[model samples]
Target: MAVQWVLVCHGLVTLLVVVSFLCGQWPIFQGTFIERIHFFLTSGAYDYFLRFVGAVFGSKCSNAVLSVEYYCCDRPNPILQIFYLGILSMTYYFIVKSSFAYIPGYYLSGIHRYTSLLAVAVGILLFLLTSFSDPGTINSANVSQYLSAYPYDNIIYAEKECSTCKIQKPARSKHCSICDRCVARFDHHCGWMNNCIGERNTRYFMAFLLWHFLLCLYGTVAIGLVLAGRLKELRVVYILTVYYGIENSFLGLAPHVAQWLLGSYNTLILIAVFLAIVGMLLAGFFGYHAKLCLTNTTTNETFKWQEYMSWQRKLNEAKASAAALRASISGMSSDRKPLLSKWRAFFQRSPLQDGQIVQNNVYDKGFVHNVVEVIYPLSSRPSFTRPKLKPT
Candidate 1:
């Protein structure tokens, strides 16, 4: 009972962490406690703790002791990177160790084990690539070039200089306060990677996500197969067979079978449950990134777009109210029109309809083009030169 309680608590904590990570990415939670918790976790406390342990043990550590203030400020720190890598490695180790030993011999005969190993290998490779890859940093040398990449649409993007970088802000570029640098087509700073995910590294990040999703999915399925094999071997289903005046219902036997399965394959069942939950979460993340790729937008841009829409809505409402007031004071017959009619007029004349509120997304060429751009970044494509920006 104690062990069961411990496992339950562990699983709940894992679930909560995963949910909090997802919510942290959402713009709605920007000022919420979820964001604060996310900030705290991503901060460099782990790094400091490790250094302290190392110092106490008289270990020779090369890295300087990072200030707590700097850590809390969200600067690039590798503390969480080790934690992430350790968790992934531990998960892979358990899956390989447990699945090979406990699963029935017949189920492990084919290329199933080889396929799972291959997925893990590929996932690790992608993870390394994403962590090390450059995320299109904007330096003084390439600032002008980046600026000419996309024309300013004047709504979400405008011609201005970054106060910190003191360089002209590119159309899609953003200054990352965490990294203390400007990034081209900046998406968001991913603490898991211990790096930014911008134009150059976004593709690698997405591929990493895909590969990780596959790894989790493969692990879960393999464990589930092992559980099924154990069930078949035990014939727990047949043992619970009921033969009486009452019909033999599988429903009646299900609870007993489940209890037997849980007791028999406890460890495998726990691993499978954890992998399945994490797999579903990864799938959600993958789908979101896929949508962003299709729309030719970044996480940063998506939040900005949401804010712009909200402001536009408010402006439209204000305009409608003013128009109604004017019509009333003038004693115009149009004042008698339905509220729907007034809203329609507002919509027709609103800045949104007139292309003032929502500007043309200069970077969005087409679906195929956008996908290609992400996969083969402009920085790598030497033959492609950005067109000159037209005067606004």
Candidate 2:
């Protein structure tokens, strides 16, 4: 029972880690002790722990240890790749080694084997493409060119230079501290890919997400079927009779059910559960990216725009209050203004209502064009004269 409890706790912790990493934001724990704990887990505590170990082990040994730690945490590394491949390999190993081969033999007619192989192949291909592809890096040669492509909106983005890169910051571009370079139309730096998901490689990143989700889904369904076949062979009537008999005698059936599940299809069931959880998480991630593509915005821009709009609202409120005060001082009666004029005045004075303070999405060239831009980036487009800037 203690061992079972430990296994359950381990599984829950693993799920929590995976979900927290995938979600990217955790508003529920904001300003809480859990948030601090999460921060320490991700950053401070790990560094401190490594330093402590280094101090104990002597400077020379510490250097080697810290270098390995930095390689895993501070930059893109093969840890995620190894973990992903290891999980897949184990799942396949269990599938082949298990006595329940009905899924591969009768149900799928050996097609499942080929499909699984293809899924893994395609997933790896897309992963490599996303990891290695240039995510529209803004260098000295093309910095000016990329700058010309999107004019300053003057709301969220203004004419500025990256202090790190020593180059002009193009509209929607941000310097990634980890990558140590300015990324054009920068989204967020993805640690999984160990690359920035920006203007150039976002399409490949999206494709990777799609393919990975499919692979997980495939594994889940295949394993689920195999488990079901094993259970069917045990006979549902006997299982149900035992379940009800225990209930009538006031004994819990949970232990019985768990024992049967673990004993009959332990490895396959574990893999299926993990794949289901991962698939669901990947689905959410894919949906988020799809929304970003549709809205013609990056993850960085989305957060920035939200903050900018909040600031704009406060500014507009102050202006409106001052205007009202001046109008009252001038003895302008509110009743004297026509209803339409009053309404117009109210709306025009409120930046939020008028939408005047909202940042112009200069890159949004309609839905179809925006998606095409992601797939075939601006860096690859033929050189042409800079077009006139569109109005907000």
Score each candidate by Cα lDDT: 0.77, 0.76
In model 2, state the lDDT of residue 139. Answer: 89
Winning candidate number (TM-score): 1
Weakest 10 consecutive residues of candidate 1 by summed lDDT: 58-67
For candidate 2, give the lDDT of residue 363.
Answer: 65
The residue-by-residue lDDT of candidate 2 on 1-392, one tens digit each, is: 56555656777887767665544246876786556656766777778877897778778777888788778777767787677668767776776676335745334456776677787888878988988889988888887788887778887899998898888899999998778889988999887778889988999999988888888888887776666565566664366667555552315655665667765556666677788888898898899899899778999999998898888778878887787689777757545744567667666644335536746777677989888888878787776235546799
- Candidate 2, superposed: residue stretches over 4 Å from native: 1-9, 21-24, 28-37, 47-79, 236-258, 314-359, 382-392
Q: Which residue pairs overlap in candidate 2's backbone?
A: none
lDDT of 1 at 250: 77
Worst 10 residues of 2 by lDDT: 99-108
To one decimal, what is the Cα RMSD in angstroms of model 1 from the true structure?
7.0
